[model samples]
Target chain A: MSFINYAAREINVKIVYYGPGLCGKTTNLQYIYERSNPQQKGRLISLATETDRTLFFDFLPLDLGTVRGFKTRFHLYTVPGQVFYDASRKLILKGVDGVVFVADSQEARMDANVESLRNLEDNLRENGFELKAIPYVLQFNKRDLPTAVSVDEMYRLLNYKGEPTYEAIAPQGMGVFETLKAVAKQVLYELRRK
Target chain B: MDAGLVMYEEEFDRITSILNRLRVESSANIVFLVDKNGQQIAGAGEIDRVDTTSLASLTAGNVAATDGLAKLIGEKEFSILFHEGKKDNIHISIVGQRLILVVIFDERSSLGLVRLRVRKAAAEIERVLTQMEAKAKEVGAMEAASPFAEITDEDIDALFSE
Candidate 1:
């Protein structure tokens, strides 16, 4: 649902980062928080558990310049990646405009990635946002780690056909903005089509 | 128009500088200066994926309902609402006269920081808005008409046409 404010000619869009535990979902947000210009970004909120799994969510509000005369702001959020936090993840998915599935690239985490993807689909469906209907971008994170699966193999296992995908090392800031830019651009495109 | 409504370059910088200062001072996930309807006027932190449109509508509905309920109970309108969910917690504060400030956080953040930062930011935001309202008065009543008020049933129908 679009909430248009007459006061400020700005449109707000919500995008979520989701995946299995240790997929760098939170790290992706941290990197953006660190690198973005001060005036263009707002608070970076992170929620984690005893073992450091994202407990609730991580949130970041960004001002991505503007399109036409309307200001474009992207609200980035991340759901807890651990399996036990399934309910939390679903709640976070409510009213999402875009999704970034941050899959852990390690071969051992392949099953986790697949299951997490399924979880995302299930949650979106429950929220009345179909997986294919909403703009989604895939991100294979932890590319810097040893024993990481090849991008080709990761894609074969997790790809949603034709969806934009990116290879990233979030902690080091590789491909973070590229992925954000892609998803944000797609979100704006979807709005224009509206 | 009060000089307050129109933010100067220095005022903008002041808010930005406050963001960097409060990012470390508090562990808040997202701090927003929004309207009562949930339209964010300004904010600091990671808020990339949260839905403000739905949030604003929901908040407005919540405020209205609560206010109505309070009136029924012979009480005043509510000035705040806190929604605690499994994944995120929202603290909504009515600031200035018409603006709303929301602080969204998770388990990893602190309430104290959220409060302190909001305290400073809210005062500044209220000051600017007070100036804006005054300026708006000077702009004449023609521009004061709400776009929403002008939206007709036909416009609503068109919105749902697809």
Candidate 2:
């Protein structure tokens, strides 16, 4: 959800990065955190297990300077993508304003991608939100892999809403900003509509 | 539930004052208000030394996790949570089921004092929150004329123009 403070002249919005395990959800956030100006970003927090897998969520808060008169802040979160972490995933989606579904582009991971998308829809529903009603985008990550499936096929399987989709190699920072910009734009536009 | 929360000047002042009062009454090191979505609304007391934003986000996450535990145990919700540390303690409570009230105290203050003060502050905060909600609903009509309404694609693109 977005929080607008007239007294503070600030607008804070929440955006969630969601996908299956090893699909680069945390990597996407890490890239953004490394590239962001230190003055414009908060600490990158990850509630992870000893193995470094996200156990709960990864959080990054970014300040996008001023938009109009209000300082725009975006809080980015990534849910634990392991299937057994459904409860944690649902909790993370509670007040989400936008979603970035990072799908593994390899041909072998297509089923995992589809399952994760369905899980996302179900989790969002439990939070009283629908995929079609919220600002959402898809990122086909791991595009540099030799076995990466075509973007068209990934979309045909996963993009039921036909939301904007990006091809990314998150470890290399490819298409990272582009995906963020697209979802952030949609969120801002949605706020104006509201 | 509303998809957004807007804090007007009047309600902001009221909340800040309540937090400030609670800080003094409870002898707290700091007190801040956070929404369920982890946005820090207002803070008072010695806040400069702490990172309010990170604390706010983590506080919300903690509350949400507790809520999940409550559900599993066949409970509606746990309205309050307290964490006792060696030197510092944190008292977290939900106000109006929409906002979180957090009080950080050290050895100088007792839990009983903080709890009592929080109960009083929660009531006052609840009243102000009710008013703020109503005001937000009324402002919905004015949103059509908001600066955001006039924002163009170019303006959005310009944010990342660097």
Candidate 3:
């Protein structure tokens, strides 16, 4: 949900990074947390398990300067990607304004990627949002892996909506900001449309 | 998943006044209002020591988890939650299904007093929010004329130049 505070001249939008297990959702958030100026970001909170896997979700709030006299802030969140955490994933998508689907590009994880995407669609539907109508982007992550699938193959299978897609090596920070920038822009354009 | 929140200056002022009054009357250390979506709307009292943003987000998560548990047990919802600590206590209550009100208090106040004051405050807050929602719907038609309507792709690209 986007919260527009006329009194404070601020706009807050919630964006979620969603995908299957070990798909680099948290890596994308960590990259943004490290790169953002201290004054423009809040503490990155990770509720994870002992093995460093996300238990519930990861949250990072970023203040991305101003637009049209309103200070724009985006609360970035990543859902727990393991199959057992589907309940937690649904909760995290409760009030999202936009979404970034971080698909694991490795050929071995293709089925997991497709399952996760289907889960995303079902969860958004339950929350009264249609995936095709919402502001969304796709990130084919783990592009640096030797066994990764080609971008064309990944897009052919995952880009059902033909949304803007990026090739990402999230750990190396490549395409991290690009993915964020694309979704954030769509969110702003969505606001203007409303 | 859009919660569709729109706050105006006048509505915010009114909500804050009610919150401030509740804080004084209940003698709570901090009192704040947050949307069910985890966005902090307005707050009053001594909040400098607390990170209200994180508090709001975690509180929402707690409520959501509890709601799931409630369903598992054949209940529709649990509207209020209380957690007690040695030095402080946290009380959270839902307001009109869209917002949550939280009060953090120490030994200076009693739960009974805080609950009493919050009951009155939540009703007033709910009233104000209803009015705001109605006004927003009325103004929705004119939103196409917003200053942001003219934003271009170049404008978005400039945001990342730095």
Candidate 4:
């Protein structure tokens, strides 16, 4: 849910990066954290296992300066993409304002992508939100991989809603900000429409 | 705006004062109010000593995880959570069913005292939240335009401008 603090002159919104295991959800957050100026970003907290896989969630709070007089802050979160972490993912989606489905573009992970999308829909419903009614986008990550499937096929399978889609190499920082921007823009537009 | 939490200056001050009073009455090191979604609404008592942003986010996440556990166990909700640390003990409770009330106390105060103060404060905070919700609806209906209505594409683009 979007939080508008009229007293503080701040607008806080949440955007969750979601996908199957190793779909570069955390990588997208890491790249953004590395690129953002210290004044624009807070510490990136990762609740991960000893092996570095996200056990709970990765949180990055970005201060996008201000629009009008309200300081717009986006709390970016990434769920534990592994299947058994579905409970953690559902918790993270409780009050999400926007979502970025970071689909691994490799042909081998096609099934994972589909299953994760279905999971996203179901979890969203559990939280009283419908995927189609929220500010959402698709990021076809790992485009740099030689085994990556074609963007057209990824879109054919994933972008059923025809929402904004970005081709990304998340670790290389390609399309990371673009994917974020697309969803953030949608969120702002929705806020104004309210 | 629908179902989202909007904090106006008036209600924020009222809530902050309650927190301030709770901090003093409970002899707590710090006290803060966070929305269930992890937004820091108001804080009191040595807030600078803690990272309020991370604290709020993590606290909300903890509450959320606990709620999940509650559902799995066939409970309606946990409602209250407490963590006993070596020095500073933390107490968290759901207020108004939408806000999280968190108090960090230490050897200076006992859990019973903190819980007592929190129980009283939660009632006041819930009343304020109810007023906040009603006030928000009143303003929303009268205005017919959001504060963001004046924001343009150019404004949004400028936010991303390096």
Candidate 5:
């Protein structure tokens, strides 16, 4: 849910990066945290396990410049992508304003991608939101790998809504900003419509 | 998820007053109200050293996780959560269905007293939020013409222009 605080002159939106395990969800956040100017961002908090896997979520607050006198703050979060963490994933999506599905673009992870997508839909439904109605984008990550699936094939399986999709090599920061901007724009546009 | 929150000046003032009163009466170091979705609505008391944005987010996450656990145990929901630290402690409770009231205190107060004051404060906060939601629905039509509605794609692109 977007919180428009007219009194504070701040508009806060929650955007969650979601996908299967090791699909570059955390990398997407880390790239943004590294590239954003210090003044434009807050501390990036990662709640992960000993093996460096995301245990709960990763949170980064980015202050995109003001729009119509209201400062735009997007609190970006990434859900733990492992299958057994469904409870944690549902908790993270409680009040999401937008979503970026970071699908692993490797042929071997196709089943994981499809399962995660179905999980996203079910979780969104449980939270009273329909996937089609929310501001959503797709990020086909791991594009630098030789084993990565073709963008066309990934789209055919995942881009059911034909939402804005991008190819990302998250570690190298490729398509990170593009994905962020696409989702942010859609969220802002949705806010205006309300 | 019901709708975006729109807080008018009067509603904000009333809610802040209640929070401030709760802080004083409960002897809490800080008190704040956040939506169930993790947005800091209003806060009171000593907050300079506190990172409220992150606190709000984590508190909401904690509540949601706890609620899930409650469901697994055959409960409708767990409406209150308390975490005790060595010197400081946090008490979180649900206000209505869409807001969370959090109180942070130290050795200055006992959990018993904080809980008492929070119970009273939560009632008032819930009333205020209920009215605010009603007012939002009433004025929501006019929001279509608000200044935010004037934002353009160029404005968004300009944000990343450095």
Candidate 6:
């Protein structure tokens, strides 16, 4: 839910980077934090386990230039990729402005990716926002990995029709901003349309 | 408004610098400032990975609910909520009357440092925000001078059409 401040003349939107465990969800954020101008980005917060597994979520706030005169700020988030943290994941999706599904390209994690996408939809449904209603994008990550599945294979398995998707090697920063911009554009387009 | 309460570009930049300095000095992963209702005001660090928006909203919701529950039991609003899960621990503290400052850290960052850094940042943030809010309210008051101040019924629908 956005808090409209007529004073700042800016609209703030919250976008979440969600995916299965070890799918480079965190790495994507690390890459963004590394490359983004310090002035435009915020601290990356990760709630991970004692062993360093993400337990709750991670956060970063970013400013995506401007639309009209409004400085658009997006609050990015990643839910813990571990399967059992479904409750926490649901909590994170409440009132989300958009979603970036980071699907692992590894053939082995196919089930996890599908399951995670399904869970994303289920959670959205529970919040009264369906997969179609929410502005969402896809990132096929870990392209540098040798055992990574082909783009065609991943697409066939993790099918989300009509939404913009990207092929990313998130660690090396490939397709990071492209993905962010696409979704941000969609969000602003939605805002402008309103 | 207090003249000393301004958070201009220079002041805002200084605060961002302070956030990074503290994060690096403290070795914390995520640190952020959110309004009383869970809207993020400013933040620093590997922020793209976490969900600060929901964190802000949920943290506010959690605090409010707990406070409500506490009131029913004849207690004041809870000031902080520290949750230690199996892997991560969350330190949620109210910053002045305006916002909540949240810091999430792993074993790499020491608890004592996070506590110390957050304590110092909270005071400055409170002062900065108090001033910003006042300025914002002033601007809002001025906007009422517009003819569109009397927005029509169809305008509301058109505004949310997207």
In order, candidate lDDTs are: 0.71, 0.92, 0.90, 0.94, 0.91, 0.72
Relative to the true structure, candidate 5 reaches a TM of 0.97
Best by lDDT: 4
What is the C-alpha lDDT profile of model 1 across B1-162, one tens digit per residue?
011122334444555555555555667677665554334556677756765544554454455456556667897767767788897788776777566777788888766666777677678766766655564456435452222334344433332232
TM-score of the A-chain for all models: 0.97, 0.98, 0.99, 0.99, 0.99, 0.95
Top of the candidates by DockQ: 2
Model 5 Cα lDDT, one tens digit per residue, B21-126: 9999999999999998888899999988888888988888888888889989999888999999999999999999889999999999999999999999999988
Once fitted onto the true fold, the runs of candidate 5 whose alpha carbons sit more than 4 angstroms away are B142-146
Those runs of model 2 whose alpha carbons end farther than 4 Å from true positions after fitting are B142-146
The collision pairs in model 4 are A1-A95
lDDT, candidate 1, A11-78, per-residue tens: 66679999998889999999999988888777776667777778877778787764444566677889
| Model 1 misplaced stretches (Cα beyond 4 Å) | B1-162
- Global fold similarity of model 1 (TM-score): 0.60
lDDT tens digits, residue span B73-130, model 4: 9998999999999999999999998899999999999999999999999999999999
DockQ of each: 0.05, 0.71, 0.62, 0.70, 0.69, 0.06
Q: What DockQ was computed for model 5?
A: 0.69
TM-scores of all candidate predictions against the true structure: 0.60, 0.98, 0.97, 0.98, 0.97, 0.61
Worst lDDT window (10 residues) for model 4 chain B?
B142-151
Residue A111, candidate 5: Cα error in Å is 1.3
Give per-residue CA lDDT, model 4, range A1-194, as digits (tens).
Answer: 99999999999999999999999999999999999999999889999999999999999999988888899999999999999999999999989999999999999999999999999999999899999999999999999899999988888999958799999998899999999999999999999988
For A1-194, candidate 2 gives per-residue lDDT tens digits of 88889899989999999999999999999999999999999999999999999999999999987788889999999999999999989999988999999999999989999999999999999899999899999999999999999888888999968899999999899999999999999999987786
Clashing pairs in 3: A1-A95
Instruction: Give candidate 6 misplaced runs (Cα > 4 Å).
Output: B1-37, B40-162
> What tens-digit string does per-residue lDDT give for candidate 6 at A128-181?
677887788999988888989998888888868768889998878998877887
> Fraction of true contacts kept, per model?
0.01, 0.64, 0.56, 0.76, 0.71, 0.01
Name the candidate, 3 or 4, with the larger lDDT value. 4
